[model samples]
Target: MHAMKLSAAILALLLPLGGCKLVPTDKPDAETAAAQTDEARMAAYADENWSTKVLPVIAEHTVDYDTLQKALSAGVETAGNSYGLRPEGEANPWNFVVSGAGTVTEAKLDSRAARMEVDMNGDGKPDVTLQIGPIIRGTALRDAMPFIVFTDFRDQIEFAKLARAMNEKAHAGLDIPEGDVIGKTVSFTGVYTMRSVDDAPEIVPTVIEVDP
Candidate 1:
């Protein structure tokens, strides 16, 4: 009877400790859950709207290189208000949707993040740098659209992933030719970001048509 009572007392003592665990089951908080999902959400946003919305906005807002140069000569903010896009209340660098036809003066195609120097004017000087990428850099495309807002994202990290996803989309959509395009003429419409009016623009092309 005493042994039975002792066993029952031990069983009662162990019952309260059943919920206690030596290892914690780490549960993600709301912000962490949102952060995990934000990349795919942004990628889906890029995929669904890239062709229908993003491209049309770019086409509508496009300022030719000559026109952009003239506007930038006035001032960076002046040019941004007239022909570029920056998120309201954010210090996002002004991004421009621009178009130009140029002859390739130099092709740096050895790297995955390759670029070309193009002579836009007949002056024979390379005027702009154009990215030809299996790897595209920068968030110029994402920044060029006023519809994409910073506050819409969970955090800066999540917001930056949108840029990465957008770049991947741009690279996948382009039909980059296989050889060095040094002497070829190419017409392009793309996005670029400028911190200063004097900054040499490196374009991330949405469309690049190389002449045969």
Candidate 2:
């Protein structure tokens, strides 16, 4: 009878200890929970703003090289030193200058840099120039209007691969050459921002002249 009583006491002690462990652990602090919720909400808002507000603006004001020069000439100012090309046939008419033939000497999934030799004023000698920037940075002006939210998560990765692939096809199906667009003239326009190359940096357009 005594032994039975001792066993019962031990069982009662263990039961309470087990219950203590199993009790609901403290939940995440209220502040942490609220912060997490806020972060998620902000991300969603940014995505929505990009699709609805930002993209439309970029479409409406697609810029070409000629247009850019005009805007620059006119002294139209912008923050970030960003400039937009006025639409063709607008009140302030702009002209695109086709000086010479341009070729895509290098192409990548995200970025394409090319060189052109053109006679800006019909000179016989070819003047060499370069065009470099993101591959896809604009939408059709008619479809969405002008929206200027530069986000290229994929292009950044592709750009990292551009230098090595300059002479070879970096993408599986796309053919890129070191000196391919040797005799063709291409037209494109985009915002030029300065970047550093070989420790030298300059402001150049993010969009290079491709097709009109």
Candidate 3:
């Protein structure tokens, strides 16, 4: 009986030592805050990368008006679609990255940069009309090539979002407030989408430099 009591006392002492308390392991507030900060930085970097690298790439590869005019004359399906045309893709008729600079003959008066005509040839004649938008519409710039696919962005939705962001950023860079760019000698490098030869080869310039 004495031995049994001794054994029972030892068991009781060991049981108390072998206990585990449930502790709630939750996400730390600091960790979440740090993660958000990092995400913001990454997003800012993406914007800058697109503006500096992607837009410029499109600009550098832009075809002149004469070449573009010819290409449009020849159907995009033919040998004309030379500079990475994405006509068969989602953005139909293809988005042509075009570069030209000349006097702004007219500006559609509005808060946004819409329907600004440019005399690209400087022959005292306006060859192509450009669209500067309160909302710069189209996915031509994004799909002008294969590199700027959904893989470049976070997802399919992000890809579209990137396009909108790019347009907004491009418009901001042009900075034609109150349609005051009229009669100014401005050079622009932007994207052109042509649905047909009849399509008014409107340029949506990613870059615009005011000469005078």
Candidate 4:
């Protein structure tokens, strides 16, 4: 009887210790790691598609300069959707592309802005002020909603990669054209933003066709 009581007391003490397993939570499993890998691959594919296909299409269909100018005169609320891509609320401080044929009357390659003067008409004054930049700024090319939707980037970093890829490709494409553009007639397409009618944009072309 004494041995039985001693055994019960030992069992009770051991039971509590065994029951308190306190298993530590494991790190992410193989399945979770595989899922993350698949997601990254998806984002990479989308980013490639944007640079190779989407950007070119958007460049091809840029709004004509005169048409855009006329539309902007009417006000962004009225013209925002019709002439250019508009986000949900404000289109101003937004970006859109423009295209036209012009003579490059002025070219300042070494300037901070790398400014250009293109006379779309025969008039003396430049209708379009352009920038061939050391760094391309503005969201006009990046803000194509349909393309952005198609990219389906899950995070800002993925989207930024998409933008940088497109911008670099465009900059490479523009390098020779910017050289040829000076004192030459050319057909060009570019992007700009409008805060108001008074906002002068330094339009920068993603594509430029030089006429021999």
Candidate 5:
């Protein structure tokens, strides 16, 4: 009886020594969960709409490179209002859907943010730069699309995520070839922002075909 009492006392001591586990009283709310997965949600959004909506709209709105160049000569805002799009109620720069065939004068495929300079007017100087990226800059594609609106998203961060997701989706579609691309002819249809008339347009190509 004494030994049994002693054993019971030891058991009680051990039980008290065992660490307490925290049990959450409530599960995360829907809004909180969404905030945590903003990037993933935007990625899924881009994937769902890219082929069905984005590409078709871009194709429909594409202006010939030569025509756009001529329009740009008039003025940035003039060209933008005539041929490009800016999201309504936003002071975002004009984004253009442009198409052209050109010769690659320089290819910086070695860089993580790879790009190629293309000479469109036979001037042997770069007229437009094509981003061939593992990393792409800007939200030109997203901004150019009339259907994608900033107000439609949850917040600025979510809208920015949408832009990044679109860029990632676009980059995944490119089949960059091996070796140097200098002197090669390529035809492309893509989007660019008219940040400045003097700046060479940097295009994020949706469709780029290398000629034999």
Candidate 6:
């Protein structure tokens, strides 16, 4: 009888111990988690519509010879002044030569702001430009928005890894055209903030007209 009672007690102890065994719970897989992250990032990049808010503001400013010269000079100065220390054999305060014209190609709204491409001149080539502006109007609130513009070359490098991944998935081909590529459209992506001439903000002009 003692043995029987002991066995019953042992069984009861085992029952509770068995309950402690770990059981796997349903969780998102790695792929699912990655996809979720990508979706979130893409959404963040597309939240602002620059065409509706910012482009009109810049376009209204108008482009002329004087403005184009000023803008080009600004770009050159910004690039030259970058990194503080000048490298060996670097040209002294280089300036962007008027390559030609650029036109607006596509404007997509994203979380970061909006991406726009404009062909400053009427050539087939489009000058890549990005515009950042307020989603809604408010004085202090406007400061929160980010606006940025990039050259097509710069944009291409910026999106290189992502573009490559996209190409791999879509199996699309890229064309390489010949001749003077200086004026060719470049790609850029980033948030931008608007600043008046007095502030001397580092911004590429929206309207660029290349001089012949």
lDDT of each: 0.86, 0.34, 0.66, 0.65, 0.86, 0.34
Q: In model 5, where do residues sit more than 4 Å from their true spots?
A: 1-36
Q: Is candidate 1 or candidate 3 better by TM-score?
A: 1
The candidate with the higher lDDT, 1 or 6, is 1
Q: For residues 108-145, could you state the per-residue lDDT of candidate 6 as single tens digits?
A: 43433333455544665443343332221112112222
Q: Which model is ahead, 1 or 6, in terms of TM-score?
A: 1
lDDT of 5 by residue, 104-176 (tens): 9988888889888999999899888999786888889888887887888888998988988898888789877
Superposed by TM-score, candidate 5 places the C-alpha of residue 76 at a distance from the truth, in angstroms, of 1.7
- Using all chains and alpha carbons, the TM-scores for the candidates as numbered come to 0.79, 0.33, 0.64, 0.62, 0.81, 0.26
Error in Å for residue 21 of model 4 = 33
| Clashing residue pairs, backbone N/CA/C < 3 A, model 1 | none
For residues 1-212, write the lDDT of model 4, one tens digit per residue. Answer: 99999999999889888667677776677655556654455445545675576566566557887887788888865556675664445523556677888888887776545667888878866777776664566655566544465236567765665555555455666744445456688677777767677776667677776686
lDDT (0-100) at residue 101 of candidate 4? 83
Please list the residue runs of candidate 2 whose C-alpha ends up more than 4 Å from where it truly belongs after superposition: 1-10, 16-55, 76-179, 194-212
TM-score, candidate 1, is 0.79
Worst 10 residues of 1 by lDDT: 30-39
Q: Which of 2 and 5 is ahead in lDDT?
A: 5
